[model samples]
Target: MRLRGVKGSRNIEDRRRSGGGRGRAAGGIGGVGLIVVLAIGLFTGVDVTSLLEGADAPQTQSGQVSAQDEQAAQFTSSVLATTEQVWTKIFNEQLDRQYNPPVLVLYSGVTQSPCGGASGATGPFYCPADKKAYLDTSFFTTMSRQLGASGDFAAAYVIAHEVAHHVQNELGILPKVDQARRASSQNEANALTVRLELMADCLSGVWARNVQGLLERGDLEEALNAARMIGDDHLQRQAGRVPNPHTFTHGTSAQRARWFDTGYETGNVGRCDTFAAARL
Candidate 1:
């Protein structure tokens, strides 16, 4: 967690200063549908692109960035840069392929995105259509206060998980999964989505393994706690709903923490392959 003097990434687009205009839901959907999409996206990392198709977003006016905003932006850029360094080496040595890093868009409230209009309500998401990771810094506050997932390492885990999705996109796993989701039943598609998200959790642990030097005491615990808090089962119970395995999009708390530990213990990309495993 020692990030002082670390070089921040220039690939970021800071939109926190802008006033993101409020608009109706995509495809003219009602508030209920938008809430469902946003709620699912908050923890599950599901692609809401289809739900946001043909949506129009209002223009935003540029404003000023406060000092606190600047700090968060710098921290985010640093985490992203670390991911670029680690993943680039991983792709070359492990897969013999080039790694293309995705842009991390720092927005507040709401912002325009190729996948759709992004807002803090949806949490952080990776939009494959635009190859960008959209994040709202306020989510960090929510993570600490509401979810009890505190610490910089927990925030970094969130960013790394989104970047891991970009890794899956580069591996062509996302498109294939999307196609399969289109052809399968809702429950079947949700199952695939769960696997995809758990794989990202594993990949984040792989990232943690590669960046051991950057980690310190209690860092791994922060990330593991974050993973546990954000699990579908945990979130469902928090919302006062019964935890239904059949409706689960992301895995259970145990599944998430276990997969992350699997990658961290093995420290091998091959070991992080969730698809090949009969049990996840």
Candidate 2:
């Protein structure tokens, strides 16, 4: 959480000045209903392309950026830079390969991606087709206010998790998983997604472990709490619904927190092999 002197990433594409157009309700779901859906998607880090497929194109608008928004942007860039440094070293030493970092696209409201349309509803997601991570910094505010997951380190964890997806893509795990998912039943595919998501959670912890010196007191707790809060079970309970194991795209709260701890404790990429684990 001590990112004061950290350098910001030059890989950032800041599109906040050119607004991504005001979002409108999709499929007759508006107001609090829509927000709830967005919250669920954001926390679960699920690809909500189905939710956005037929939605109208967002109108572009211009707006002045708020100071708080600017600060969030800066923080995001700093965290991304740290990930770049940590992962670069990891690739060279561990994988014996070059690390090609993904661009972090900072957008406001809604944006377009090869994967689909990204709004606050889609939360922060990585488009494998483009190999970029997209984020709406306001989701950080939503995390603190609504999800009860605050702190800069918590936000950093979210960014790292998305970037971790990019790492999966770079390692060719994503393509193979996608192919498997396509050939799988709905339940089987969802299970594969859970492993993929939990693996990303673990990889994020690996990044956190590498940056241990920069972490302050309670930083790890903040991240673990965030991981717990965003678990599919917790999100289901928060939504006033009973948790259903079969429908879980991400793992349970305990599983998420445990996997993150696994990476942090070991700090080894091999330790994050969720796909090979008999138990997740």
Q: Top lDDT: which candidate number?
A: 2
Instruction: Show pairs that collide, candidate 2.
Output: none
TM-score for candidate 1: 0.87
What's the lDDT for candidate 1?
0.75
- Candidate 2, residues 1-280: lDDT per residue as tens digits? 9998999999999887775465742332222111222222343433443323443222234666777778889999999999999999999999999999999999887676666566665668787777888888877877776677889899999999988988988999888888787799978977888888889989999999999989999999999999998888887777666887888877898998999999999999999999999999
- CA RMSD of each candidate after superposition: 5.9, 6.1
- Collision count of model 1: 0
Error of 2 at 25 (Å): 8.5
What lDDT score belongs to each candidate, Candidate 1 first?
Answer: 0.75, 0.79
Please, what are the lDDT tens digits per residue for candidate 1 over residues 65-155? 5566567778999999999999999999999999999998987667766566656556787777778888877677767766778999999
TM-score for predicted model 2 compared with the true structure: 0.88
